[model samples]
Target: MPARTQLSALRTFRPSKRLKVSAVALTAAGATTALALAGTATQSTSALPAIDVAKVTAGSQAGTKVEGLTQGVADKAYPAYVGKPTAAAAKNTSRDLTKAPAKAKPAAAAEHKAKPAANRSTVRKPVAVSAPKYADNLDGWIRESLAIMKAKGIPGSYSGLHRNIIRESSGNPNAVNDWDINAINGIPSKGLLQVIQPTFDTYHVAGTANHLTDPVANITAAANYAAHRYGSIDNVNSAY
Candidate 1:
């Protein structure tokens, strides 16, 4: 062969050093991305929707990880597959009341929550009508109220039984009745219960101060009325 032909046949080719660095850099980046995706896949799936682990492991063994490489992309790829609410739900939120949610009626619900209600039947005034009241002394009217409870056949639940006595006269003999309920006859209702003339006339004896003004007698009459109507002196709660 001629010298020029021989020299042309022998060619020297050397790849640039950067090509080796580029391959190493690319391999490192791919490895890092793989590590990150692996970590994300293993993260606490406690709140996540259920995924079949056996199928994932089978796919991984079958080189499915390389096939699913791009699927691990965070916001765009993973979330696109998930179906979440496009907009927030504010219809039932408290900041806006227009939703008119089904709930307990406001007035009734508030009343129930407030604890102490205006069940006046059970409300007792803190102070005795005037003061200086001794439980043992309990006054003639209180005694009569008890007697009336006995006559009526009511149970003597002290809290309930005394509730009426407290209402009528606060367990005081000096307590007067000046209530507005009229008796229709000449005598205005007076004394502990404001008993009228007709009621007093029916129950009162001629001589004893059992007239409408007498506290003990009036209380006793009221007790009798309660006993006759409700059938128990202790049935004080029913008096109201």
Candidate 2:
């Protein structure tokens, strides 16, 4: 047989085998192209040609005829060629999901809780104070009486009260005038200032003990009487 005649005979009988071989070769080429494109996925897609996965997959499956595959068919066949995510992108997403949120400091939270409110009102308890102490003598009594007299608005001096007290009772708080005219009538004059019970009761200052012989009470009442009768005890030098 001639070589040309033998080749024609092979072409007629083994057409299906040739078609299958060509389809397989085309599928492998397309896959290689896809892999090369995937290696440079991070680069500009504007410069790269769009792949036709539909035609490749159709050629592989039919082995009889190959045609342009639709977008839907291409998506099902080669997902990597249609916006497939990279490993770095997937890793970044996983890192973001696993990251922990920032927490508030314990010390700052405690300090905020411990702080006092600005609008809160506070109350204070009253303190008790005792009266001032004085010595147990004539001078002490006079000084104490002067303080009381000043508070009561009665006018008298220390020298005037002291002088009258000495002249009347010789500084004796328990002095009495039993032989006087007032004593004859049963109302005897008594105390440091020789004040009778009626006179003492009439001019007795409040807050003092209501006893004629009580030095402070006696002085205060007598001074008060002297202030009324002669303007002040300082104005009276002798018996009036």
Candidate 3:
């Protein structure tokens, strides 16, 4: 070959080989850099000193200085590390321990005293009343009927009741007029005041026995009828 041609061929082939050498060199450099970094990390890990927990605790308790630990850091780590109280703080504590509490103000005490108690009236217990007692006789029946009539606003008296009862049935509670006009109508006049069944039932007062032969019931009913028809039993002189 000629010299120029050989020189050109050598230049093109040398550039390809140079490119490969550069790539291989770059790969080796990167591998070496990675190995160096790993070795440096391992050395750094081995070189670090192990922490002695017991020594740190002893140093903190004894108030001795721990290596690389500031006083603030020591206080945060060990809460038992308390600084001495200042002179003013000690004096204030002593005063608090020895001093007596303040008394209530005189004006407040006076105002409390001036306030009056509530005006509560005492409630009295109710007095129980006993009912009136009566004898089991004609006088008793008439008297009892008068009391019931007075309460019911029926106008009659003991005298009027006695007079009518004597004329009608002669004071007999079980007296019956079976031959009278009322009896002929299928209704007999019965009891102390000789009241018929219909009249007795119609004018019957409450709180009295509902029987035709009952002395008090008979008197009260007859008196009630008389009062309605003749203004009062006292005004009726004959059968009504």
If scored against the real structure, what TM-score would every candidate get?
A: 0.31, 0.54, 0.50
Per-residue lDDT of model 1, residues 82-128, tens digit only: 33224454343536667677899999998899888667699677874
lDDT-based ranking, best first? 3, 2, 1
Q: Give a tens-digit lDDT track for model 3, residues 23-66.
A: 45666668555334434444554443433556556666676766
**What are the Cα lDDT values of the candidates?**
0.51, 0.76, 0.77
List where candidate 3 sits over 4 angstroms from the true fold: 1-125
Question: In angstroms, how far off is 105's CA in candidate 3?
Answer: 28
Point to the candidate with the largest lDDT: 3
lDDT of 3 at 47: 49
Single out the weakest 10-residue window by summed lDDT for candidate 1.
6-15
TM-score of 2: 0.54
Ranking by TM-score: 2, 3, 1
Better model by lDDT: candidate 1 vs candidate 2: 2
Give the per-residue lDDT digits (tens) of candidate 2, residues 1-240: 455654464444422454456545666678554333433332333333345556545544454233344545555555554454478887877766766887779999899989976753656576889899988788999999999999999999999999998999898888899998899999998888899999998999999999999999999999999999999999999974
Judged by lDDT relative to the true structure, which candidate is superior, 1 or 3?
A: 3
